[model samples]
Target chain A: MIGVELRKLFRRPRTWATIAVLNALPVLVAVLLQLTDLAPRPGEGPPFLSAVLTNGALFPLAALAIVLPLFLPIAVAVVAGDAVAGEAQAGTLRYLLVRPAGRTRLLVAKLLAVVAFVLVTVLVVAAVGYVVGATLFEAQPTGGTSVSGTSLSQEELAGRSLLAIGYVTVSMLGVAAFGLFFSTLTDSPLAAALGALAVLVTSSLLFTLDAASPIAPYLPTRYWLAFVDLFRDPVLWRDVVRGLALQGVYVGVLLAAAWANFTTKDVTS
Target chain B: MSAVIRTTGLVKRYGRLRAVDGIDLDVRAGDVYGFLGANGSGKTTTVRMLLGLVLPTAGEVELLGERMPRAGRRVLPRVGALVEGPAHHGHLSGRANLSLIDAAGPGGSGRTRRARIEEVLDQVGLGGIDRRPVRAYSLGMRQRLGLAAALLRRPELLVLDEPTNGLDPQGITEIRELLLELNRRGTTVFLSSHLLAEVEQLCTRVGVLDRGRLVLQDELVRLTAPTGATVVSTPEAGRVRAVLDGRVLGVDGDRVVVRGADPAEVNARLVAAGVPVSALALQRPTLEEVVLAAAGTSADRVEAPR
Candidate 1:
């Protein structure tokens, strides 16, 4: 079941199209930085944008920051939101259920496919960022400076980049869970996708409010960008670890809810 | 023969509405059971519940002698179905769609998956079909593809709803033949359709559903059995009416319906009376008349409340 679902997801033209579209913004940023050499002042724009002008290796991390706020989450929401609702809308859900494809197994397969999409999408962003950043900017292949102004070796830089990618993937899993949960509640893929986005929008909104400070730590999107802490000289694990734990809770709870609702749903479609 | 699909007091309620109210369906092995009903008589709901797609609000569903929605994991793999109509992923070719659906469940061995897809496609009359995406298929083609998917596993029991819905007359004939052939090969068939003509031609046993209730269930032969009346066709209808006298129940055009169970006996009496009989046979009601007399008004019709 999982293999079949993965084929369906990857064979779709929309999946590749989404990935290509995701790389567009980061590539555009790299080109602009190369032509004009006007990088954002330190800590002003994206996290590593200023540093990417001197060391291309850091540009991948900069690229991750560029689309992290809104673009990547929206992409994840659309795909995950379509997971089950899309099948229902297309009238195939009934057939699958009758295939004796146990409802629980189908849901699990869909979740795995969504996770695969998140991983592939994040890795592409980082990889494309590395290529564009190297070709467009100056490169110090030996090592690069960390966010804390401490020099890090090439191996250390590579390790942190991978860690950052993994962190982004985990954050996106929370978004995917929201989309998947909503997907089970409706037959309209668009509505499910929008519903997930609504939660993210609300969470981000509350994260910025002083009155919501007490609830900030509990908000799903509050620690989404904590990957920036991975670039600290000693690797500030506080916010990064908190973000992972927070996303873990959200993914676990939302998936459990999704499984419960879907397994018992009347597949009239 | 053992029962293939059985239900006891199967009911599905949508809040205040009883979509399927207490229907006890008994479909036996090797029988082409026709489930007859109007548009809103809950036939589709019934099949959905049996296949575990919709849970029954009350009562039990047993497929192949196993309880449903619970034993579905073990029972459903042996049953194939086409509910309401056929549906498939439009972007992929028909073959691709079949392969994916077959792989989604257990018992579909990967080594034989390709051969299985080809065999079912041919059975549904798509043997010469190319790799064009199903989005480009006509309604008839799509319907055929749906049947192909249902037959991919060679299930022991086939549950089909309006199987010939989108087909042309010839296409309909082809599917009926295919279904009958499958039935002949030891596979039980539970056919749910509103088209009386289609069911009359294909089913051995019939059940009529009226407003979520099974109004009639019996052998088609018995329900449409000889009405104990002999129909006589002759040019001199008046002479036959006068000759039969009290036995002549009614006369229409050149035909007369007289009270007699045996056509041979009626013919001898007509011959002795010097009446020329063109055609004489024992009368039997059409399936349509039997159903209309047994079932209530069409569920789709709504009359103003007093």
Candidate 2:
């Protein structure tokens, strides 16, 4: 099932198109940064390139932010949302359902496929951003300067980069689960994808409000970029734990609702 | 014989319209049972219910002796279905679509899967269709591919909703032959179509549904057998009706037609009644007539089965 799903993922033109566009955004940002006088002057132990490194983190984050509202969640929704609905629309649901594999097994296989797609997509953004950052900024031996007046060593920076990327991956998982849940609700992949994006965007908007501060921390959107704290002199585990926990809750709730609706749907349309 | 498929009071409603109203049906093991119904008469809905793809609002369904919805997983392994229109990922090659389902179970190594695929494809006359993308396949070829998928698992029961739909004459004949061959090998076949001729030629037993209700269910031969033959001799028509009894047989015009009496006996009774019968001939209702009478519509309802 995984092999089949992977083949399906690669075959879709939209999948590759999304990846290509995402990979280019950071490079474009890198080009613009190179042309402008936005960095610290050279000969300052750390040159202008190093100054951009502080901003390098933003490339992936920005890419994610822009992509999340329209592309990331939509991508997740496109793949996961089509899990059952697409097959139903294509008339293949009956064929798959008749197989020896149970419905739960089929759903799990598809859900995992969506998760795998999410992982690959997030990795693409990380790889593209890192490569572009390295090429444009020049290699720096040090990690990054911490927010609390401390500097991170080379090894520490690599660790933080990995941690940050990992956190982003986690955040994307919530999107995938939510997309899969909507996929079971409707026969249109576009509808499912858009629906998941709508939910993510709505929740994200709510998270940005000061009035929502007390409850915002509990939202999945709130934890999306929490890994930035990992680069701090003393890493803040509070936000990290809270974010991971919130994402887990979202995944659980979404998957549970999906399973419930799927098992009971009449599936005529 | 053990029933391979059975349904009791199965119902499915879409808002106010009951797409599949209360229905009770049975298909015996190794039996090629024809489900005769017009479009929107719930044939597709019923098949979806058996496959667990559609939930029923009320009643029970059992496939291969296992109750439905609960035993769905266990029963699904033994059944293969093609509901309504044949559908697949248009961008993928025919082989790829089957491979997706193949990977789902039986755990065959790549070589085993390829070999099985080849065999099924050959069986369906889709031997070279594997290399072509589904988007390029003709309607007939797609139907064949759908059948090939169903045959992949060597299922004990095959539920095909309009298996011959959208096929040319040659394609139709080929599928009919293939289905008969499969049945000969002990696979129970359950098929639904609006074509009475196809069902008459292929099925041993049949069930008729109209407006979501199973109004008639019986063997094909029994349902299509002549209600009774009419013997006409202007004056003896009424006398013939009297001899056979008005309830069992009646005179219409110059002929005596029995509603549910054997033609031979009715003829014998008329001869002994001293009615000068000018003509004595047997008339048996065709499959179309039975279906029409059951459906409560003109013979137009028998348009085409697949």
Candidate 3:
């Protein structure tokens, strides 16, 4: 069932369009960095934007940072939002339910499909960023010097990149789950995607307010940037662990609600 | 024979409106049960309940000898259905849609899935167009594809709601013949329709519903058999009316409808009275009449024949 869902996902022109648009962001950033020949000052822009100007190998991390705030989540939202509601709108949900896939199993497959979409989009951005970074940015003068002045091996770089990509994937799960839950509530895919995005916007808004300090620890978007911690020299696990835990809670609660609602739905469509 | 589908006091209420009121239905194995009702008469709602698509507010549904919404996983594998209309991904080809649905079913190895899809597509007269996207299909072609999907699993019982809807006359006839052939091969069919003529021609047994209530349920032959009156048309209408006396149900133009009298007896009396009958025939109430009667409407409610 998941394989079928994946096939359906990849066959759509919208899926490829979304990936292309997402990859374009990193490409644009790389080209601009090369043309300007001026690195961003410290504490400006995304975390690694300035750092990548000196070491091309860190460009994947910078690309992830640039897109994570909006581009990546929006793409995730579109795919996840369309997961069930799109099928319902097309009048296919009734046939799918009647096949005895059982609502729970079908919902799980949809969630998995969204996760697969997130992985593919993230990897595409990272890959495109890597190639652009290598060609446009100057290689390290000392061959492979870390920001902290320690020499790094190829294995270490690959390991950190994998960990960083994995963290970003987990961060997007909350949005995927939110999109799926909204998908179950309505038949309009656009509404579902917007609803999920609305939640993210609200969470981000709350995170910036001093008055929302007490509730900040539980917000869905709070730990989204924690993937940057994986790139720290000492590899800080504090915010990363907290982010993972928060995402797990969001995924669990939202998916449980989705299952509860979907299994009892009348399926009038 | 054991019933393939049985429901007891099934009800589905949406807030203040009861879409499907308390009703009991029995569809025996090997019986072609025609579910009859007008639009919004709960025909679709009842079918949804039986298939576990809508949870009943108050009732029990036993499908294929297992309790529904509980054994739905096990029971649905043996039943095939097309509700309202065909619902498939318009972006996908007919073959892709069928393969996906087939993979979701309980049976069929990967090797046999292709063969089964081919057989059903051929059976439904869509053998050549399987590669076309559903978006390009006409209404009739989509309906045929819906039937092909239902037949993919070689189900023991088939439930189709308005299967011939949106079809041309030739298409309707082809579907009718196809359903009859499937029944001959031992697949019990349960279908719902508003067309009295279609049901009358296809079903062995039937249940009629009106405004969320079951009005009548019986064998098709028994329900439609002549039971009301004998119609006699004669040029000597005055003489015929005078001879018929109390047996006359009604008089319309030059014909007199007489009840509780045999055609031969009425003819003999009319001849004795010197009323030469141009036409003497028994009026077998059509299924439409029975439906109207069961619906509690007066016989004259329908438009009179010119």
Order of candidates by DockQ, top first? 1, 3, 2
Interface Cα RMSD, each model = 0.8, 2.1, 1.2
What are the clashing pairs of model 2?
A143-A153, B194-B305, B195-B304, B195-B305, B226-B284
Q: What lDDT score goes with residue A157 in model 2?
A: 71
Residue B299 of model 3: what lDDT?
21
Q: Which stretches of candidate 2 lie over 4 Å from their true place?
A: A37-50, A53-71, B13-21, B106-111, B230-281, B297-306
Tell me the native contact fraction for each prediction: 0.84, 0.69, 0.67
Which of 2 and 3 is ahead in DockQ?
A: 3
Tens digits of per-residue lDDT for model 2, A1-269: 66666777778777788778766755675687677846444334222233564545334444554455455666676777787788778867666666655667777888887777788888887777666776666555555566555877878777776787688778888888888888888888778888877887888888878887887776667776566577567998888888888889989998999888887777675
lDDT of each: 0.93, 0.76, 0.88
Q: What DockQ, between 0 and 1, does each candidate earn?
A: 0.83, 0.46, 0.72
lDDT of 1 at B167: 99
Clashing residue pairs for model 1: none
User: By summed lDDT, which 10 consecutive residues of candidate 2 chain B come out lowest?
Assistant: B227-236
- Residues B59-103, model 3: lDDT tens digits: 999999999989988989788999999988888899999999888
